[model samples]
Target: MNTDFLVIGASITGINVARELKQRFPDTTVVVIDKESGCARHSSGRNSGLLDAGFSWSPDTLKARFCKQGNQQLSDYCERNGIPLNRCGELVIARDGDELSDLDEIQRRAEGNGVKLEPVTARQAREIEPRARVHEQALFFPSSASVDPAAVMRQMEQDARDAGVRFYYETSFLRKAGDEFVTTLGTVQAGYVVNCAGLYADQIAQQFGFAGNYRLLPLKHNYLESSEVPGAFRTHVTAAADLSGSYPGTQIFLGVDGKARLGPAVKPALWREQYHGAEGFHPFEMSSVVTTGIGQMFQGGGEICRACLQRFTGSTHSRLITAGSRLVEGIRASDYRDWARPEIQPQLVNTETHRMVSDFIVEGDGKSMHLLNTVSPVFTCGLPLASHICDQVAAATGR
Candidate 1:
């Protein structure tokens, strides 16, 4: 075999997997490939750029366990390598009486998952952010942090390169040629392959006949920038309320650069992994913007519904709407100069059942392995997950 392992994606997942493999087996030859000319062209590069100290996961799952560990690991890495990371923490604000109950439930989940969370009064939340308008209560997690996603991804690429792992940019894995894989440039004979192909992971897994269990449902997450909060403290903020019945809740955030932004409204898309505005603006991208606005309104409850209705009507939704109204006070929706485009994230939708895979899925029979639906905090849990994947492969191969 020309190489011991071939990782088909250069995002955080693929690069961290390669890094772990190299650390475990220094003699093994590992190569990483990405269709883009550089790493993190998709979800990894475009995100809220938060470290996510507080994650929502069942206690028994790998996501819950690894998320906390990964948060610490990622923060340590940033500090060691001089990567820019903001331990800004996160505040889940409760805007109404009902949201207080949701905040309490989140606190219970966090405690069970071994994550630290504290209930704070509106006064305390105001102390954290004088401009924050949490009318009822709030949940504060001091461990949450944010980082420049692009910087962290670039650092991972540099680390992998320094560790002697080969990387090929503008290269794509076309298909499987018997037991070996064929790429656009050449064929690579490898003993085993790892598919961390973020948005298209399921497609790549099908080439190896291991993707029968799941399919990729691409969701477009959009972000609207804010100039209202200038030089704000480095802290990630979110809504404690269940905004339109989504998992992580509906929320707005401030990046490490101190720019507030809202969005990442989940809208289903037909294509597998399509990023809006990467090449040019498309009209279809606006379809989900309205839905996202509606979701935000629902999360805000009755008090904000009128504002949501007004802003979403006519061509106002087509262009940037300044966050001037009482619904999104202290935020100018117009401050969002341009859409940061859309990020194509892979959600595990079971083809047979036609339902979303609520949990992470890993399938293999010892010699080879495939990771499907490694979304969200997967980047945070990459190192530990890589170790687990390696152990699984070792048990299968008796390596």
Candidate 2:
């Protein structure tokens, strides 16, 4: 196969890159390949589907740069495509006075990132979500929304196909063969390559001499579906912050259908694709992940270990209920019996620093570009991130 631009991994990022490239360079051929039978079978399809309003990171980070815009663009995309969207918004509440400052920090980030965040009194918060609890004040993200991820992805794939972006499903990238790539399907000769392979992106990029110091640290994210009627909660609700200062703690995410979900226990996984018991098991990857995790636990003054213990060593449902109960009333273990589809977060780690990377990493030269650490909120940031990546591709290929 020969194409002007070849995109590996047909998830949100890869699909958007192909579509954007085709849009920008109409004369050039753009193609996307994925090992799955269809697009977004992995992380993209299994996400929480919460369109973030971009207050998580500082303004200096790339995540901040893309998230707010990505949220708006994606919200617009859903509306234009007639996809269902619940504009339920999100509430960041404080469990107590100790965590109140974190809300302030998040509000500061919201302002810095040029996103609107409303400071609501506890009464106002309850007015928004009757079950919501707050110590004094809570931050409301009006732009925050949710959709059926699978629905959005199907629409996006269709959009890409309609735009003349060719997709080769069940096609795997094998190796680089001298200015071209050897894939399971056939030899692919492309002018430029973009890697968005998720779990295996770092491994693929290593072949192209990028992502040398970065490696995939897969975190298994699982959510609990609430049995209560839809609209059990009027909006997504969560506490201020957790140990890592990110919002990975117990919280409830409302789907586009208004169903409440609690979870996303971000625990370290044994392998890259270790979604369930022994599924997608890779002995080599497991060994590497265990060793790396052990090393990180020792180096971070046991911070990683403490975080792991707090998150991983428990009945996941009970932990979620406990944490989520603090944010809103009426959370019980029985109501959250069903576990949603679990996903592996292909998080990137700086091997040398023994730290998890919180921002997106893009590395490229002339031949190829690699996107690493495109983790949570990436689905929300897909459009803008795709645009940024295309800019990198243009610069690298002189397009």
Indicate which candidate wins on TM-score.
2
> What lDDT does the true structure give each of the candidates?
0.69, 0.86
**lDDT value, residue 361 of candidate 1:** 69
How far is 158's C-alpha from truth in model 2 (Å)?
A: 1.6
**Model 2 lDDT tens row, 291-314:** 778767766466556656766864
Can you tell me which runs of candidate 2 are displaced by over 4 Å? 300-303
Q: What is the C-alpha RMSD of each candidate to the true structure, in Å?
A: 6.2, 1.6
lDDT per residue as tens, model 1, 1-399:
379988888987788878878877898999998998999887777766777664467677778778888888888988998987767678777666767777777777788877887778888887876666686687788888778888898998999898888998898989888877888878889878888887667777777778786655455556666656655534556666542133553445767676766654555454545454344443553444344334443442343344323323311322323221221345555565565666756776554554456566677764457788877877777667777777777777787
Worst window of 10 by summed lDDT in candidate 1: 318-327
* Candidate 2 lDDT: 0.86
Worst 10 residues of 2 by lDDT: 240-249
- TM-scores, all candidates, are 0.84, 0.96
